[model samples]
Target: MSDADDAGHRRAGRPLETVLTRPRITAAALRLIGATGYESFTMSGLARSLGVAPSALYNHAASKQVVLQWLQDHVMTMVDVAGFGAEPWDTALRRWAWSYRDIFATHVPLISIMAVLPVTGAPQTLRMYETVAAGLASARVPTAQIVPSIVALESFIFGSAFDVAAPADIFETGALAESSPIFSAAVRQGEQIQGKARADVAFEFGLEALVDRIGRLRRP
Candidate 1:
């Protein structure tokens, strides 16, 4: 073929720019979840948000579950596990719990999704668990109790994360206030006596209590 004809053929076969990548896809997926939430987050919606065909997402992820696993691992990378090796076990647990709850407070949807999802393929998530488990073992917690204790602590953290988003008047009894005067008064008192937000104060209280209880479980 002539040089001009060869150039024309090369141009015809040139691939389109690769706009979709794992990072970009994950970012777009997170934005879609943030904007529309888990209930409305579908592969089709994600593709629409990324301005690509749904087939493009499939090129990166096999299914919605796979994308969610990627998101879970990415999110796990944000949780604070720095205290595990440097601080006392209790202190490390406290630091990790606070960071975990804070990160998930804005990602409540992921909390629900991840609650049902396993950690088999999520390496970051598994790393977090390993750190916490090692910390517990180092602290002399019973082998049988470590997993349950972790689960219990996580249950509190997840609930507290949701509570962080609750309105200040979430406890308002409205017309029923008069019927439960004691509870209403306590709520009002709690609102007034705070350096930290009420939800935070409650979280600290619960976390400390759990920590103390776990400490008592130490082997002799």
Candidate 2:
């Protein structure tokens, strides 16, 4: 074909549509947060990273809070809620708790935001809750107690995520060791324990206690 004819045909083709989408926005938001942290994250910054104007982002998400809610839901997808129906209640709870703590350990920055964020519009987050609630209900836990129980586990998991990110010598008393011998010695003893991480040990110990208490809530 002639170059002129080819150019005319190309001009007649459809204009390229904007590829912006919720998943793309969610991905870009996460990348932005990982690079600059939540403190610096902004709708304008997200648009910059995505190669679009801030108005384009607003087309999918109304506000930064809404974007964060979307991010929260996206992060929830990484957690292992499948065990709820497949495993025993206690076993499922343990699996879910470990997965939750581990996933959030790398995402400690999101914890404060997510802790207070409601699950109302976050479908994945709500789905996770539904699974846990169903498992607890199947174990015969009172309907009214289900939400509180889940909240208790989440409180522990969130705290544990922070603990996981803490330095190994987070308990180090150093120059003050002589002033607080017992606590210092306990810290040293904990350090001396082999194999598992201090965070894992503490999480397991606390999880067992919580599970024991929650298990007792079941009707005979």
Best of the candidates, lDDT: 2
lDDT of each: 0.84, 0.86
lDDT string for model 1 (1-220, tens) is 3546546655887432244556666777888887878788899888788776888778877898878778877888889999987999999999999999998898886787778777887778889999999999989999999988999999999999999989988998889999999999998888777778888999999999999989999998
Global Cα lDDT for candidate 1: 0.84
TM-score on alpha carbons, each prediction: 0.82, 0.85
Model 2 clash pairs are: none
Clash count list over all predictions: 0, 0
Question: Cα lDDT for residue 122, model 1?
Answer: 76
lDDT: worst 10-residue window of model 2: 14-23
Evaluated at residue 213, the lDDT of candidate 2 is 92
Q: Which stretches of candidate 1 lie over 4 Å from their true place?
A: 1-24, 31-42, 48-51, 62-65
Q: Give one digit per residue, the lDDT tens place, for model 2 in 85-191.
A: 79998999999999999989978877887888777877888888888999999999999889889999999999999999899888899999999999999988887
Query: Candidate 2, which segments miss by more than 4 Å at Cα?
Result: 1-19, 34-40
